[model samples]
Target: MRAAVLTRPGRFEIEERPIPAPGPGEALVRVARVGICGTDLHIFNGHYAAESLPMVPGHEFTGTITALGPGVAGLEVGRRAVVDMNIGCGRCFWCRRNEILNCPEMRQMGITMDGAFAEYMVVPARLVIPAPDDVPFEVLALTEPLACVVRAARKAQVTFGQSVLVIGAGPVGNLHVQLMRTIGAAPVIVTDLSPERVRMALDCGADVGVTDPGGLRQAVLEATDGRGADVVIESVGNRALYAAALGLMRKGGHLAAFGLTGPEDRLALPILDTILNENSVAGSVAGMGQDMHDALTLLVHGRLTTAPFTRAAFPLDEIQQAFDSINDRPGDLKTQIVLGEEDTR
Candidate 1:
């Protein structure tokens, strides 16, 4: 077996390693495709605080079960599956409250455990969701990220006919736009500095895509007949974008900050203004069980197409090239690594 091992913050090696076996309550999966997420880039650049060195950092992936541990019911070997990266102890207080993402002892795949950037990875059986037979392995790899989008949309309380604005045209941002539309919202307005992404967003159903704000507040107000967007989702983590998002939102609009902020990140906003406008800001992180399930259901039903989101693929041997391409290619959407020869075909 071969795996991409991160021995240090800025270094990774694709080395021959012994395949791991499934422990009790775990399942051994033959990794087919692994989506290289922004978190993986952060880990590669030493910017992710939660990831430790000498770890495998691939959370979004899909595979086939080669073996199942004892006592794992409702799951069978040979089933196609996608990984749910968030692994939490069921006994935790947060888990008890249906908020496993907030659990103190949460151990995410690729962060605390060997992730799917290998020939094989072991994960708790319950965390593996069955992938649709028609869904390509590469597309199935997006399940985890899609789950995150679903969670954020829920937190934002996106309603039918509500005008929404998503800041950022990257994979997550684009997904946000598409998902919001699925729930009966009006075509979303998307913003990003990359003109290529702006165009891409238009192809994917964004009503308006702009590099500048495009007088977004003014434009949206006119579209809504003097009312602004009902919900503003800040998928871009830049601190400056926070204030900009607030400015574009309606007086009583809900703002959901889905992107993670760095520890030292700070924002300067007038509290009184936010209060007077009846504006509320909420933050959402990784998905819970329901989010994961909903993501798979939508994907399987052909409502959430993952094809537009995937841009490139690389063999496992050229994992470094995969990372480099994702970093250098602005036009690329989802860059995935093919961990198995069969999957590449």
Candidate 2:
């Protein structure tokens, strides 16, 4: 087996290793496609807190089960599947409450543990969700990020005919726009610094797109009939964007922060305004078990299209180039690494 190991920050080496065997209640998957996420970039830059050294940093992936360990059930060999990255300790207080993301002993694949940046990886059977065979591997690889967006949307509690303002038109922002529409959010508005992404957001069902911060406020107000947005989702993890998102919401509107930021990152907001306006702020990270299931269902039903957001696929040998494409190309939405030559569709 061949694996790309990040021995340190800004360094990766392709090395050969013995194929791993599945342990009890685990499964060995032949990785097909892996989507590079922003967290992977942070890990590559040594900024993400949970990532350790000499790790394989790829959480969003799709593969075929090659071997099932003892005690595994409901999963068979040769089934196409996607693995949930967040693995919570069953004994944690949060896990007991079914809030896996809040578990202090949570271990995420590709961050704390070895991931699918290789030809094969071993994963717990319970964390593997069977993917529809009809969907392409590239699209199936995106279920992880889409699941995160699903969690964010649920946290927003968007109601019918309510207005939503997503502050960023990246892949996650576009997913938010589409999900908001599916959930009955009307006149979804997206704002991004890149005009190309703003256009992409519109293509993804956003009623309005704003490329400039100067126009974003006015656009939101006009779209909501001067009342401002009912929900504001901040998908860009920047301090300025966070502060601006706080201002884009209506009185008593909900604000969902879906982007990942550094542990020490801080935002200076008007505490008095938040109190007086009775605004609700919530932070949502990775998706839960149900979110993953819902996201995969949406994808299988053709409700969510990842084709427009997907870029070209790169072979595993060009892993460095894949990371570079994400850093250099702002317009590119999803960059996939193809581990096998078989047609994943």
lDDT of each: 0.82, 0.85
* Local error of candidate 1 at residue 257 (angstroms): 0.8
Tens digits of per-residue lDDT for model 1, 192-290:
888888888888888877786657667667766677788889888988888778777888888898877777987676799888988888778877688
> Estimated TM-score per prediction?
0.94, 0.94
Which residue pairs clash within candidate 1? Answer: none
lDDT of 1: 0.82
Q: Write the per-residue lDDT of candidate 2 for residues 138-215, one digit (tens) a residue.
A: 878888999999889888788779999998888888899999988889889999899999888888789999998898
lDDT at position 212, candidate 2: 80
